[model samples]
Target: MSREVAIRVENLSKLYRLGQITTGTLTHDLKRWAAKMQGKEDPFMKVGEENDRTKKGGSDYTWVLKDINFEINKGDTLGIIGKNGAGKSTLLKILSRVTAPTKGEIKIKGRIASLLEVGTGFHPDLSGRENIYMNGAILGMTRHEITRKFDEIVDFAGIEKYVGTPVKRYSSGMYVRLAFAVAAFLEPEILIVDEVLAVGDAEFQRKCMGRLKDVSVNDGRTVIFVSHNMTAMQSLCNRTIMLERGQIKMTGDTDTVINHYLNTYVSTSSTKVWDEHESSGNDYARLRSVKVVDDEGVAISNSFIEEGVNIETTYQCLEEGSKLYVSLVIKNQKDDLIFISSSISEDVWSMNPHPLGTYKTTCKVPGNLLNDITYKVTVFLIRNSTDVVYTAEDIIIIEKTDPGNNRRGLYGKWGGLVRPILDWRTIKL
Candidate 1:
C-alpha cells in the first residue's frame, strides 16, 4: 500500500444541545458566525462538555466528538469502535458532509461515499434504480460511468428483481444491501460505513464484509468502518481506533486495539447474583447467580495456575419436560475464548430431561490447562440443545496466576494459551 495520506482530520469536535429549543446552540453558532463574519477566531469552539448520555452534564451543549484526529493511508482500512453515544456516527456524518463540525477541519483528497444510518442518502419516494443514479451523481460520477457499473451493482446487491421498486417499500436487509452496493461500486476514493450490516443476516453480512475488503485491497480505496462486531472489524481492518465518551481512546493495530477495548471498556465481574426483579430468562428457566469458587466451595478472585477451579451456577427451572443443560465459556484477559464446556460433555447429562426445580450445576477447571492470566466465565442455560433458556454473559471473572509449582520450571516465558503437561519419556540409548 502507498504511504500517501488519503484523509486527515485535525482537532474535530461536534456539539449538541439537549432540549427541544436549541437557544444555547443557536447562541453559540451565532457567536461563531459573527466572529467568522468579522474574520475573527470562533469563540465557542472548545467550550462544550463531554457527550456522556448516562449522567446529566451541567452544560446545555455537549461535545458529541472532541478533538478527534487521525490520518488514513491511501488503501488502508480503519475500524472505529465504541459503545452507544460514543460519537461514532457523528464522526462518520462529519466526514460524509451530512453534518459540520463545531470546531476543527478535515482534509480529503478524493470523492467520498458513506453508508451511515438507515435510509441515508436515499429518497423514500425514489426507486432503487433512480436512487443509484442520484447517489452516483452526488459522488461526482457521470451518467455514463454509473450506467457502466449499474448491472454489477444490482447483481452484487442481489436485488435485481427489486431494482425498479421504491426503496421505501423494501425490507431493511434489502435497503442495506442496495445502499452498501452503491457505496462500494460508485468508485469513491474513500468509503465510510457505520453498522449498517447489522440489519442484514449473517450471509449478507459476510458478503458486505467481502466487498469492503475487495474495495480497499483490489480497487486501492481507503475504508473507514464502524461496528460493534469485533470479529468483522478484526477481519476487515488492518488498523483500528477506539473512542470513549466523544474522545479517542486508543489507536493502533486491530488486534491490540480490540484487546484493549474488550479487556478495559467491556465490563466484567467475578460473581453475579440476579435479583428477583431482574429477569434473565424466559418462561423456561431463570438464572439466580453465577460465581467462581475454589475446591472448598468458597468464592475466590485469586486462583493459581496449578490449582483446580470450579464454576457454580444456580437457576430455577420453571417448565416441565425441559431438557436443560449448562454451557460455560472460559476466556482470557484479551477476550479470546480459551475453552467451552457443555453439560453434555459428561455422558450422564446427555439427552436427559431436567425437571422443574431449583438446581445448581458446577463445572470443573483442571490445573495446567490454562495459562497464568485473568479469565472470565459466561453461563448459558440451554433447553434440548437448541433453545437457550437463560444466559449471563461474562458472569464471573478469576485471576489465575503462576505459583511456580508446575513441572515446567519458571525459567523462560511459557508460550501459547495452555500449559498442559504431556506424557514424554526421553530415551538416550
Candidate 2:
C-alpha cells in the first residue's frame, strides 16, 4: 500500500507590514493609495538585516515566519523546535488556518483542530461544559460524538468539580487542561498543537504526551507539535522539522534533526554579545562584554572539554552606592541550567561600595570537568538583593568533548544538570 500525504505545503510564505496601522485609518489609506500608484508593495516592507527586539536595535517587523515547505504523512508525528521567534508557532498557525499565509499554498486532508492557546474556542462567560460542546462543534464533531466523549474530556482535564463554572473563573492551568482535553478527545484527523503543554505541571504534561502518543499510534492520526522542550519533543516525535527565521533548516529522523537544530540553529557566539550599551534590565548592573580565552591569552570562540579555558564577563555599574551581585549560569544545549555561581556565593563583597565603572570577572573551567556537548553562558547582575540591573541569557556558546566516550554518553540517560567525573570505588559485592 502506498503512503498517504496528510498535509502538503508548497512555497508557503507569510508577510506583514511593519510600522503601519493594522486597522482602518485615514493615514494608512493614504499610504496604500500612494504605494499602489507607485507600483510598490508597502512602504514599510524594507527587506534587509533583521533586528532582534530581545537585543538592542532589533528590527520592528521581525519575520516570525517566511517561506516554508514540508509534508506530513498520515500517522506521522512531526516535532517543531527552535529558539524564540524562529517562526515555529507562525508556521503552525498558518497550517491550522488560525492565520493565513502571505504567499504559497497548503493542501490539508480531513478535519483539523489546533490548540494554539489556552481557552482557544472557550468563551470566558460560558461554563466548562458548554465550551466543550461548543469547541467540539467547531472541530466538526457531531452532537452524539461530543456527548460520548464529554465525560472522558472532563475526567482527563481533572476539573469535574467545576464543570458548570464559567471558564473565566478557571485558573490558567485549568483553562489549558480543559481546552486541551476537548481538542485531544475529539480525535480530529489532523492535530496541531503549539507550546500549550509548557504551562502545565510536569505530571499533566506527561499525561498529555501519553494520550497524544496513543492518538497518533493507535488511531492513525497526523500530528504537528511545536515545542521548545527538546527532551519531550524527542520522546514524542518520530520525525522532526526545524525552522530558523521562517525557513526550514533541517528535517529528518527525530534524533538527528533535533541534534542538528540544537547545534546549528541556536544563537552563535559571534552574533550575541553582552555589551552594556546593547544589554540592560531591572535588578542589577549591565554586562559590558563576554569573551573566552585559552592559557596563551588567545581569544577562542569554541573549545573542547579537555582544554581548560577562561570565561570572562565585563560589567558596568549604572548607579553608585548599590550592592553589586553578578552570576554566571551555564546550561546544556537542552536549555537546562547546569550550574549557577554568583558573586554573592563567594561572599567576596559585603555592603562595600562599588565604583560606577567597567569591571571584568573571569571563571576557569578546567579540563575533564564537562562532558562532550554544546553549552551556553548567561550573565546576571543584581543589586541590594532585590534590584536586578541586568540579565543576559544564552549569550555565549561553549563546547566540550571527551574523546574516550565516543559521544555516546554525552547524550546519555544519566540525566542531571551536570555530568561530572568523580572517583568511584567498588569493593566486590
Candidate 3:
C-alpha cells in the first residue's frame, strides 16, 4: 500500500462452518487432510451445503462472509452500515484485528486504535487515572506522550472528580466517557469505532462525534465508523459501505447509502395487528396493534411538519379492575429519546379507566416544534411503578418536512434536540 492509502483490502473472504467442528487431533485431521490432497478445498466450501436445523437432513456448513473488496485512503472516514445481522460488526472485528480473515489479505500501513467495545481496555481494579495510562500504552503511546495529552484527555472525559477513584465504582456513562476520551486523544493514524456512542447520553454522544470529526479532518487520519444510527452516519462520514449478509451490497457516497438504507427500512411492514393473546414482552398487558393515522383514519408513517399525528394503540386487558396506563416515547433519528410522555405527568391528559376489553389510545404531536428528521415511536403500558404491562420500541416512524419559509434559519444557527420557536421579550434599558 502507498502512503496515501491507509488501508487496502484485496478480495477478502470469510467462511464459517455452521455446526461442525474441525478436530485438531491427528486421526480426524489426517482423514480430512487426505481428502483435501485431491483438487478440492474444504468439503464445507461446496455449494448448497448450508445447515437447516428445521429441516430433516441438511449439511452443517454456511458462509458468514463471501468475497469482499474495498480500500480506505488516508483522512477518509468510511461508515459501515446495515441491518442487524448484516456482517457489519464482523467486518469491523476483522479489521480491528480481533479476528483474522479466513481468506485474502488486508494491508494496513499505520498504528491502529479501535473502540469496538465499551471499556475495552479498562481494568476494574485500576483507578481512572491509571486506566488512562494503561489504555494509552496499549495504543502504543509512551509515558511522555501520555503525559503531554493527560490534561486534554481528562478535560475531554469530564470526570476529573472521579479520576482518582477506582473505575469499578464508575457508572456505565462515566466509563464510556473516560474510555472514549482516551481512545480519541491517543492520536493513532487509524481509528475504528463500532457503536461506541450508543452507551452515553445525548450530550456526550455529541461530544464524542465532534471529536471523531476533528480526528478525521483536523488530524488527517483514517476513520472507520460502524453505526446503526443512520442520521449520525449521514452527517459524519463522507463515504459509506452498506453490507448485507456478509456481502458488500453497495459502496458510495453518504447520501446514496443513507437513502438506500432508509428506503429499504421504510418499505418493510411497520405495524402488526395483535389478537387477545399477543404481548409486547411486558407483564402488564398485551398489545393488539399500533397505528398512526390522521383524522380520516388512514394508516401512514410519513408526515409533514404542519400535519398532526394520531397514534392509535390497542391493548388487551387480561385481568379486571387493574389500572392500565399508556405512555409515548419519541426518539430522534440518532436513536436518542427526545421526548417521553408518561401517565405520571400532570400536564398531559389522564388515562381514562377502561373496562375488560380492547381500548384505543391516541396522542397527537403538534407539528410546529419538530425539525426535518425521522422519529421512532415507542409505547409503554403500565399500572404503577412496579407494573409494566407492555413496552414496544421503534414501533412506528414519523418524518417531518421543512415547511417554513426561512430555510437558512433552520439550517445552521442552532442544531439541537428541539426546534421550538421561543418568544423573546427585549426591553431597552
Candidate 4:
C-alpha cells in the first residue's frame, strides 16, 4: 500500500543578513528587486556561509538552513531534535508560513495549525473564548464548527473559569494550555508544535503528549513535534530527523536518530577532568576529576555487560572538619534515571567529618545488573546529609556492550534498564 505524503520539502534553505536587518543598505534591496524583475536568482544567495555559530565567517549573510529535503507522510508523527542554534525553530516557522524561505519550496497538502510559541494565534486583549473562535476561523473553520468544539476546547484546557478573561492577564502556563487546546481541538489537518509545551506542568505535559499521540494515531492527522525532551520524543514520534548546524544530520526511526544525536552532539566520555581554575564546586570543596573504571582500576569508555563497572570521583575538601559524601546518578539515553547511589553507605566516609584534604570515592556497579546500552553518570557532592555542595550532571558516559559470553545463544535486545541474572528453578507441578 502507498502512503500519502502530507508535506514535502525540496532543497529548502533560509538565509539571514548578519548584524543588521533590511539587507544593510538600499543598494542590496534594489539589486534583489532587479533580480526578481529579471526572473534571475538573488545575487547574494550564494555568498553566505553555513550556520556555524562558533566560527567567524567572512560573508555578511548566513544560511540558517541549507538544502533540506524530506517528506512527511499523512498520519505520521515526526520529531526534530538538535542543539541550541540548529535552525529547528526556523524550519517550523517556515512550515507554518510565519516566514518565507530564501530558496526552494515546500508543498503542504492541508491546513496547518501551529503552537510555535505561547499565545501564538491569540490576541492579548481578546478573551480566551474569543481567541479560540478566532484561531478556528483562521483555520477556515465555519462559525458552527467552531461553536461546536468550543466547550470541548475549554474543558481540555481546564480554563473554563478564565474563558471570559483576557488572555493578556493569563500566566505563561495558562497561555500554553489554551494555545495547545486551541491547536489540538480546532481540527486542522496538520499540527506543528515546538518546545513551548515545556511551560505547562508535568500533568499537563503528559496530557498534551497523550493528545498528540491520539491526534496522529487515532485521528489520522500529521504531527511535527520539536522538543529537547528525548523521552517524550521517543514516546510520540515514529520517525525522527536530527539537525546539526542547520543541516540534516540523520533521518530514520526514533531510537537510532536519537541515539546518534546524543552521541554526536551531546558531549559524553568515560573520563572528565577539570583544571584548577575550571573546577566545579564552591569555596568549601571542588571536584577535580570523574571517570569510569573496571575492576583493574583502568579508566575505560567501554565495558562488558558481564563485568562490574566503577564510577570514580576525586575532589578536594578545602574547609576543615566538613562532613561530605559523593553520590552517583545513572541515566539512559532517554534521560530516565536508572538509579542513584550515595557514598554515605561506606563505613569509612559515611557522615564522617574529615580534615582538609583530597579524597577519592568509587562506586561499583555489579555485573549482570545493567542492560547493554549507553549510560550517563552524574556526580553530586554533598555537605553533611542534606546540603548539596556541587553537582556535575552527565559528567561521564559509558557504553556497556554485550560480549556474547552470557547470551546462551539468545541475541535479542533485552528490555528495561537492568538485565540481571536471577536464579530460577523450573519444575513441573
Best of the candidates, TM-score = 3
Poorest stretch of ten by lDDT in candidate 1: 345-354
lDDT of 1 at 225: 96
Q: How close to the true structure is residue 305 of candidate 4, measured as C-alpha lDDT?
A: 86
User: Per-residue lDDT for 109-198 in model 4, tens only?
Assistant: 999888787565679999999998887777567789889899988999989999999999998888888888877887888999898667
Superior by lDDT: candidate 3 or candidate 4:
4
Cα error, candidate 4, residue 294 (Å) = 14
The C-alpha RMSD of each candidate to the native structure, in angstroms, is 8.7, 5.6, 5.8, 7.3
lDDT of 2 by residue, 1-429 (tens): 789999999988766544666565466668868998999886544552342435533444455565677898999999988777777777887887878986689999998988787566679999999999998888778999999999999999999999999999999888888988898999789998888777777788889999989889999999999887787788789999887767787889899988787767565672245443443654335666776777776668766666787777666666676677677788877765578777665455533467777666667878767666767887777777766677676777776545555345455444445456678798987
Which candidate, 1 or 2, has the higher TM-score?
A: 2
Q: What stretches of model 4 exceed 4 Å from their correct place?
A: 22-41, 121-125, 138-142, 168-172, 270-332, 335-429
TM-score of 4: 0.66
Better of 1 and 2 by lDDT: 1
User: Candidate 1 has what TM-score?
Assistant: 0.63
Can you tell me which runs of candidate 3 are displaced by over 4 Å?
Answer: 1-3, 16-40, 47-61, 169-173, 267-271, 274-287, 294-308, 315-329, 332-336, 341-374, 378-395, 399-429
Model 3 C-alpha RMSD vs. true structure (Å) is: 5.8
Q: What's each prediction's clash count?
A: 1, 10, 3, 0
Cα shift from native, residue 348, model 2 (Å): 8.5
Q: Name the Cα RMSD for model 2.
A: 5.6
Best by lDDT: 4
Query: Which residue pairs show collisions in model 4?
Result: none
Two-way TM-score contest, 3 vs 4, winner: 3
